[model samples]
Target: MDCPAGVVTDNYDIVEDDELWARIGIDWSERSERSERSGDGLDNELWARIGIDWSERSERSERSERSGDGLDKVDKLDKLDSETVASPTQRSTSLPPELLRATPLYEALSGWCRHWQGSDSEVELFHFSRPVNSIDVFLNLGVFGVMWKAQWKAYEGQCGSHDWQTSRWMKLVTLFVVFNSQAAALTSLLLSAALGFAEVYVGAHVLPLNLWVFCGYMVFLVQLCFWQRIRSCFVAPWMVFLDKMCIHQTNMPLKQQGIDGLGTFVKHSEKLLVLWSRRYFTRLSLGGTASLVYSVKLL
Candidate 1:
């Protein structure tokens, strides 16, 4: 994708660069020593600081770069097992492996190596291998929803529709009365469309989950990366403020506020997509219905 300068690139490594480290308040000079002992790997502390699981990083070997001093120290401690006793200088230098491992520097270095090394079948596929024109795709075809045609036609006929067209943010209200309704396909489709790819492309290339079995975790990751990149784009792409996904619906206090905020959300929105189905109206008390009514009132 030909993104204007400042937009997120397909190169995910940029996020791990010195600029990001400085922005996140890391002292690289102090931390750079860690990099030498461990080649640019992240610890749980750094991962937590950045709101990512330590395991989410690309896999690498554990404790692969023990310093010569550390190894020599360990070797001296081993000599104590011999029949011949060592000299006072050697005895003084000898320290238990556990104590060595417990030292602050050693602990920090070990922690880096012990970070989550497991992988997820889904997460691996959601990784962006390339960039596409997500903005142009969104502006041209809009998003996917059951009521997209009628709602879009009505909006286009209205006098203020032109303003809505140019506005950066669009509201995609996924409506279904059944909270437990099957949304795997919808989730996959919406996510792929948001990032300018077909669901097949997303599954096959972007983050392939074989046999159409989608993972909610992968979807969340896609949403996160999509929004993060959009925020950096010169022309901010449309944001999908999914109700149940984005808002705290189960928490009464927050749910009320989120329900009430629907008016304001739609007030600034360009497109309102209603994924209407038999399941939508049945759960009128669930807030999807209220969100649509409140949004339509603003329109």
Candidate 2:
């Protein structure tokens, strides 16, 4: 007020004003005009040219913040959608279904539902109830020497192994009974079916027919017929990886997994019962002994 102000000082005051001041000039009259225009919520010619207006700072900032937040949320949603659209299997299996619905997996499932609804056993909806223990309270084991059959009785369940999370200290049995021919596997299968049916319907006395059961029509009861050893371990629901029933023959992926996991199976077993005979080793170098070779290598 005491001294005449310079052009820089005049411009600085206008720039720092709480309201938008009109006309960026050093003239006092123009500065007074800017003050008159302050409270109107709009600005001068320069601001108008750019389509900007003097909206309240707080309100404008609030709107900008909301827009930023919305954009961030949109980006996350888009990423989730791309993942599901690309491949549904890539979705994390760990997330609970409630949370999964907003994700792209929900979209993928919706798209999939329109085409074909698989069996209830195979697919599930929002109310995804996990499998009720398919393994019975008691194990109905059918131990066939055949490639894909079993004759199981209702043995006890593994008391502590509810989630298949057994202690490493607990070693189980893996019956390595890979014969050189399919006939051997067939005989073992027949024996399993016969013994299972008999024990349930006829009596335990008829179970002895298994001893005469030859794999490949040979005189070999190679379904690990050492009942005394096996029977001793039956007090607990012993995890017996029986030869025929252990594989998922119809499922190629499962079959390959079983084949690949043989080494691990042998390593963990407390008892690796190899149902070996002269024939197993006699044709050890031959064609059909691939199973025998894998078993031998694993051992």
Candidate 3:
């Protein structure tokens, strides 16, 4: 029988036409027969024909189920082991092997090793040691250096404004007398002890010598104290005051001028105090007290 228009027949004796069989090349009669045999078989056959093997698929599914069963067995074993084992509190307190070898502090410090070993910058080294120890050392040194420089500059300026010869002579005499008396008394004491003479020194002699030495040292110390006070109260304040005055003299707007004046004063004053305390007071009071106690023991 001749086929209808746009109809074609395949060797499978399937009749196809454009409207009904364009997709699979199967005719409508074959499709109906295949659909009658089993509704889902054609889809499975098509999948199989395209290199999709159902046997291999079935094997993979079975293996997956077996793996799931094995995992369930492992979970059951874990639960049993947990119940049979000792309590958590009774577990060993020993550190793990790896952790014992590489401690947390070691790890933290090790992270900075590259920075320390590689860098030539002293500033970076200073910062590197800051987390450990060098911060306090550098801070104390910086404060003292700045303060010393400031004081020396102020002293030089003051000397330039005055009679240089008179001021120089007075300073020279004060230093000489202070050092001479202290040295003389100390030498006398040492000689007396070194001579090994029993009952050699009379109270009359020792008393006046001790008094001279004590008084001389006290005077020198008082001078130093006066110098420190002058620096803090007069020199420092005057510098800050001058800076503020300079700021106010500027031709800025009123609001900006006020802010600048206040800011400059505060900044200088804060710096002065920080330098004074960290530099002078910390060294003189804290360090000296420690040294004094040490010296007394030696004496």
Candidate 4:
């Protein structure tokens, strides 16, 4: 009998039984042979086997290059050395005995006063007065000295940036000088009148003409000295004002800068004035208390 179209016959059984034929369950050996194929069957398997090692090797090489062991050791040493540091030495410079006793503030004031009055004799007299206690002198002198030092340093630093001429410092100095001069004159006249009255009432002997002349000269000198010292006191405020004015002048582009600057100046000035007044009041109170105590003791 003839084989059906889709059925395998005995003659084709041999081809069908072949391994390649068994894969497809067909007998088309001739057609299978004619079909050309290329490429190694093991190529994908081989690539898979080598790819992992290649990636590992690339990673190892990169790590080695980045390690830079020598540089790392040097950096470690620098850090360690920095951490093991030694302490610095202390320095103390002692002032001279005379200077230490006098206090810097007092010296500056005295000097300024002397310069103005063309004589230090009046200051010397006042310096020796009973009411001018040691504590008061020390406090006043020390404070004045410190302030003068600070101001001098500031002046030195700012000299380069500021015009020394036409500075508010000059105006301030002038104002205080004039005010103190008038004050000193009035004080001297009052003192003279009081002394004269006391002498008359107590039947005390009048001072010789020469002594009176000397006292007058000393008073005049002291007045001039006080004027100068007072002028120095005004320097700080003048400097502050000048600084604010300069800032305002320089920052013209900012409309509110000037106003803000002026406000700050006012605030600081108010604070300084308040503090000064407080100190003055405190001193006055202490003086009054001392006077009262002395009067009680006398009575």
Q: Is candidate 1 or candidate 4 better by TM-score?
A: 4
lDDT of 4 by residue, 191-238 (tens): 788666766676455544444545655775676556444555765212
- Candidate 1 residue 293 C-alpha distance from true site, Å: 3.9
Lowest lDDT 10-mer window, candidate 2?
A: 154-163
Residues 127-177, candidate 2: write the lDDT tens digits. Answer: 321211121111111111322212221111111111112221111121222
Computed on alpha carbons, the lDDT of every model, listed in order, comes to 0.33, 0.32, 0.30, 0.31
Better of 1 and 4 by lDDT: 1
lDDT of candidate 1 over 237-290, digit per residue (tens): 333333322234245554444344333333333444433233333442423343
Better of 1 and 2 by TM-score: 1
Off by more than 4 A, model 4: 1-163, 166-173, 198-206, 227-263, 267-299
Report each candidate's C-alpha RMSD, comma-separated, in the order given: 30.9, 22.7, 30.4, 29.9
Candidate 3, residue 162: CA error in Å?
32
Residue 107 in model 3: lDDT: 19
Candidate 3 wrong stretches, greater than 4 Å: 1-207, 228-258, 261-299
lDDT, candidate 3, 80-194, per-residue tens: 9999985422221211221111111111123222322321223222211111100110011111122211210010010000111123233233323432345445555655554
